[model samples]
Target: MIALDIAIKNKYYANSTAVVLKDIQFSVKPGEFVAIIGPSGSGKTTLLNMLSGLEDATAQKLLGNSKSLHDCKEYQLGYVFQQPRLMPWLTVNENIQLVLPTAQERKIKTLLAQVGLADKGDYYPKQLSGGMQRRVAIARAFAVNPELILLDEPFNSLDAPTAAKLRLLLVNLCKSCGSTVVFVTHDLSEAIYLADRIIFMSNSPSSIIHQVNVNLPKPRKESGSTELAWQSQLMAQYPQILSGSVSTD
Candidate 1:
């Protein structure tokens, strides 16, 4: 299980202070998929950084499997950022190998195939399309068999078709790996399709305003009536979710 109770403060300028996040609290069950949805500047990425122990915060307490995040040295974590962040000089295969040097060549090749890039292993980041690069990042994230995976709008840049394909790929990988996933996205429909639970935050100086259980069966179909219905319900119930305005004070 993963649990967090944290607050974050930022000094965006010399004279002013901004509380990017306040009184944030949530938990994720083992092998569960959770999605965080909020406005553009609501500090969602900052929350991810705190979970990954990459940022310092004033009142941060993160727990994983009953151990403090700082003390849980045995848990393996993986991250897929908005951008692929691949090494331009290395081939696709080399980029994944860089992280998992002990992994066999055949296993690496198998991963490439899983992401529909089996034939592109020898290509560099520049040679592949944007979506393909993102796939490489996804494959790399799973190559290490991490216990917790964090994703921050990894498909935001892709077109609808590409994004849908990647989402399916992600779900398959998550099912196979059984890793706890915390995904942050602005797309509510996407959230409904992929997450077991959706956490909605208010505007900057954000706090969790609502949490919705998807309760949708797995292997969700893309763009079906069921998904559309849930999306409509969410939008009607929480219209401020996508474009939020909340008083920080």
Candidate 2:
């Protein structure tokens, strides 16, 4: 269980204080997948940071398993950033292995297979396509077996088809592993496709404008009426979400 009662009293600027995120409150159950989406400059990444205990909340509680976030164990988190952020010099297998606890080569091979990179493990980051690099990044994150995973637009650079396939793989893996996912993305369709619930936020000085609980059945079909309907519903709220803001603390 992860909960964040987030409120930002004030924020820093070049010469003064400004507010970024305010009155942001949400609770995520174990094994639930929640996606946060907003325009650029919104507090999406900042929000993730607070939830992961990389930043402090001005006047709210951040809890992991009902305790303070900072007090929680570090191993509970598995983060995948927007960029692959992999070392160019490291082979795909080496990169994933670097984050894994074991020295077993089979573990690397297994993760590569899971991310659809089994044949590309020996290739370096520079040798892979953008989507492939991201796959390697995902493989690294999953290798940790974290209970709570945070993803920040990890598939943004991929084509729609590839992205959709990866999303399916990711959601299925999360379900099978019983991992709770807090993913940040700008893609509404992707959110509708993979999330159990979608949290829509306004631009900077952000807060939740709407929460659309995805009612689509599991193993979400890429092309189907149910998924399309939910996607349309979330998209309909985009304009309102972009134009509003909420006070934090």
TM-score on alpha carbons, each prediction: 0.91, 0.87
- Candidate 2 lDDT at 242 equals 38
User: Which residue runs does candidate 2 get wrong by more than 4 Å?
Assistant: 1-16, 57-59, 233-239, 242-249
Per-residue lDDT value at 229 in model 2 = 75
The 0-to-1 C-alpha lDDT of every candidate, in the order given, reads 0.84, 0.77
Which whole-number lDDT from 0 to 100 does residue 126 have in model 1? 98
lDDT of 1 by residue, 15-112 (tens): 45757777787888888899999989888998887788776643456778767776767778889998999999999999999988485799889999
Can you give the lDDT of residue 230 in candidate 2? 62
- Which parts of model 1 have CA positions greater than 4 angstroms off? 1-16, 101-103, 245-249
TM-score of candidate 1 to 2 decimals: 0.91
RMSD of each: 3.0, 3.6
